[model samples]
Target chain A: MGESILSGTVFAAGISVGPAILPGIFPLAPLLAFNPFTEPVGVIHYMIVGAVMFTAGVVCMALKRNALGVLMGIELVLNGANINFIAFSSPYLRGDGAPTLGLDGQLIALFVILLAAAEAAVALAITLNFYNNHATVDIDRADDLKG
Target chain B: MTGTIRMDSIFTSVLLHLPAPTAPVVAAVDWHSVLFLLFAGLACGFAIAVVAAENVVRMALYLVFSLAATAGLFFLAGADFLGAMQLMIYVGGTLVLLVFGVMLTAQAPLVSIKPSASDRALAGIAGAALLAVLLAAAVSVDAWRKPGVGEIPSPTATPLGMALVGVRVDDPPAGAPLTGRSGYMLPFEIVSVHLLVVLVGAAYLARAKRRKTPRAIDVLASSDPPSQGAVLAAAVPAVRTTSGAGGKSALLGGGH
Candidate 1:
């Protein structure tokens, strides 16, 4: 019984090891290691998703000449940060006895969403005004202030 | 139902014959990871699509889908109230933006604006570098990789509501002796006021401006420059708003 319990604990700990380094160790290593398909996810997985979204947002902002496209990028970036906050705040996603962000993270995320909304509204309004003044929404053409 | 019962019986029999120790752990599928992957992929993929698409309307549509997927992720992460709010407000914002897009694109000349290929390449390279840095930082943390305690906490919205009104119902973890966790009452009130201000300000800025003279473009296009100022002043009636600013009267209708 003691040996069985020890094995159970070992299995639980081993599941946390990510699948990247487990290729040749054991025949069933894929099942044992932390692949998203087989093993339960940790906070790292959520961070990865956030990072991808943020990168896409940055690319969108830098490449798009349309002012609205840039606004979309800003929203994506904010949403990425919000995802990180939610991951940290979730009790089920925290380590055993780990000092977690708890409610603080969620609260911060909520505020971020609210502020993002306000920011978007103001930004769209400004975009509209810019379009009116220049008769164009092409941000590349808005060079009136250029020396 | 009968098929499900028969399948369950077969599954039970197979499980009974297998090694007892690892059976429970092995059979349990990680639904959370599956859901996370699904939502995250949709969100990221649509975001990338938005970046790549040159058509303004298509970009707006992609953004709406991306944000909706993000709300799915929020729900998966257990922020139920936030997920709902994200759905409502983000979708509403997208709708307003879509209307703006339609309004702007009603004019045939400015429907799409494409960036040069060189700009796209440079932005892609920069984005990749940033992503590498972010991913490395995220993965380098040891504690964040650890498996969770695997227990669902109580509903988040009630305590969240309390916290917004200057009351914290949830206690800090026993191991960490934290000082009093102050609520977000101040920030909440401040944000509410800020939102109101933003709404009024946005309306003001976007409002049509009336000018007695023709638009700068029209003035520049005409040949005679000596009497341009006089001609503009006499061209339009004083009572007519002339689409507030520029020549957007056709697109915007009467200036509101």
Candidate 2:
């Protein structure tokens, strides 16, 4: 029994190591090719970071019960989009002599920040009104219109 | 054994002939990528923390850190004006307002309302799918994956300012048709008016009003379990009266 168990362990190790040693078969090999510390970052790097933030925001919006939490999620979503705009607009990030988005991207990001502030103010006001009316900030309790 | 000995002898000879160790070869660190990593890690980590944290105040705090780090990213990307705007308006103005809203409504049972297990599972699945799609799209673009040219452009504040007021002082890029680029003066005016309208509307919506009779919420509050009900019942009258009186005073002051 001990010999059989030892053989099974060896087999399992082999199975795990086989794909990792092969070039194309390794799943993470593609990702490992680019080293961010040694190589300069590009627009794609910023987009990936933005994507993570955007996902977290969507999850927050979907899962949170507090109105303010939802509002925070909205802010996160806007911020993720803003990062993309900044990355695309950056002259440094463009390769092959491509024309960057120039001032337009920064200008749009500015407007997004401005609009986000306005939206937050209005949303907070609406939330306050809802809180005063219902005496609760739990969105689940907002069922008066649910006919 | 003989073949192994022969291979060992050749390997030793190769090692002995190698150049003597002198200055250690250190790989040059790209400060831009290092800073990008630092800021991106902070932003993404805190953003996830905002989602994971149960406490409302902690979530707000995490959001603040995330946004501040995002401002650092903007600075790293060469948008000095936008970065400053992000710090002043987003972290300073909007987050402060959000915190105020949180403080105002954070009664005991409402501070951390845990979502149901099913809701969390569903949202997790959906968010994972969305992230996969977005990341795939982001990485699939070959042009975007190419390393940047590392050329820092001139300051954009002057051009941005000029463009906002109907002047396009910045030169067009090489080989680009310049005739179609339009100034943002029209949108700037519209945004200004929109902000004014939103300011008034929010104030109007949040104004305290006197009620002739107790509403459904008041009845519900009174019927709640004694511990929570007593606290809410006591707090409601105090808050209502204070805000109401304050609103009346403000209106009177405006009249004067």
How much lDDT does each candidate structure score? 0.72, 0.80
Q: What does DockQ come to for candidate 2?
A: 0.33
- Candidate 2, residue B209: the lDDT equals 48
- Model 2 misplaced stretches (Cα beyond 4 Å): A1-31, A97-99, B1-27, B174-179, B210-256
Top model number, TM-score: 2
What C-alpha lDDT does candidate 1 achieve relative to the native structure? 0.72
- Measured against the true structure, the TM-scores of the candidates, in listed sequence, are 0.75, 0.75
Q: Which pairs in model 2 have colliding backbones?
A: none
lDDT of 2 by residue, A1-147 (tens): 223332345344644555467685443343445455545777878888899999999999999999999999999999999999998888777665555677788889999999999999999999987776566788886643333
lDDT of 1 by residue, B138-235 (tens): 76676677766666767889999999999999866434448757899999999989999999998877665456656555444422212212333333
Interface RMSD of 1: 6.7
How high a TM-score does candidate 1 get? 0.75
